[model samples]
Target: MKEYSVVPNKDVTGWMVKIEDVAPEKLYDERDAAIAEAEEIAQKNKPSRVIIMDQNHEVEEERTY
Candidate 1:
């Protein structure tokens, strides 16, 4: 199964949506925006999931598509 993650960017300037451990697909200034986009992408690719992370870079929540 595939996995999409909404995590803080390395520099902590913003959040990003990445597929698995690969490079980020997009970036967002707000966490909510990143989560929304990740969910949308996860839904399009069923059997996948979205892993939401907090500012501390810890897993906060997870949603399966």
Candidate 2:
């Protein structure tokens, strides 16, 4: 199964959603938006799970698609 993570963007003032096999992380203005984006990516890659990280980059939640 693939994995996607919604984490904070250290280089900017927002969140990011990155997939395991994909380069160039997607940036988002909101954490919830980032999670939503992760969900979308996970949906596209069906057998994947989305991980939500806190501000400190700690895994806070996970959803399997």
Candidate 3:
């Protein structure tokens, strides 16, 4: 399974979804590039909403009941 990490702008007023992932050097670089590209596209389009989806992989440690 593949996972993506996303970071949205701080303002939260625009439609931009940045997606990234942990991987080899080349793939990581590509992911960064992809995020920049997506930001540009969202800025131009100005959609009503922007959503970022990432795979759930991390396991949450259980607390004592």
Q: Model 2 TM-score?
A: 0.85
Listed in order, each prediction's TM-score against the native is 0.92, 0.85, 0.32
Q: Residue 20: error of model 2 in Å? A: 1.0
Model with the higher lDDT, candidate 1 or 2: 1
Task: State, as a TM-score between 0 and 1, how close model 3 is to the true structure.
Answer: 0.32
Q: Candidate 1, after superposition: displacement of residue 38 in Å?
A: 0.4
lDDT by residue for model 3 (1-65), tens? 12223332334223233323333222223334644544454455544222343333232221111
Best by TM-score: 1
Better of 2 and 3 by TM-score: 2
Tens-digit lDDT track for model 1 on 1-65? 89999999878889999999699998899989999999998889899999999888899999998
Pairs in steric clash, model 2: none
What value of lDDT does candidate 3 attain over all alpha carbons?
A: 0.33
Q: Where does candidate 1 clash, by residue pair?
A: none
lDDT tens digits by residue: candidate 2, 1-65: 99998888786589888878365487889988888878987899889998888988788998999
Question: Sorted by lDDT, highest first, which candidate order results?
Answer: 1, 2, 3
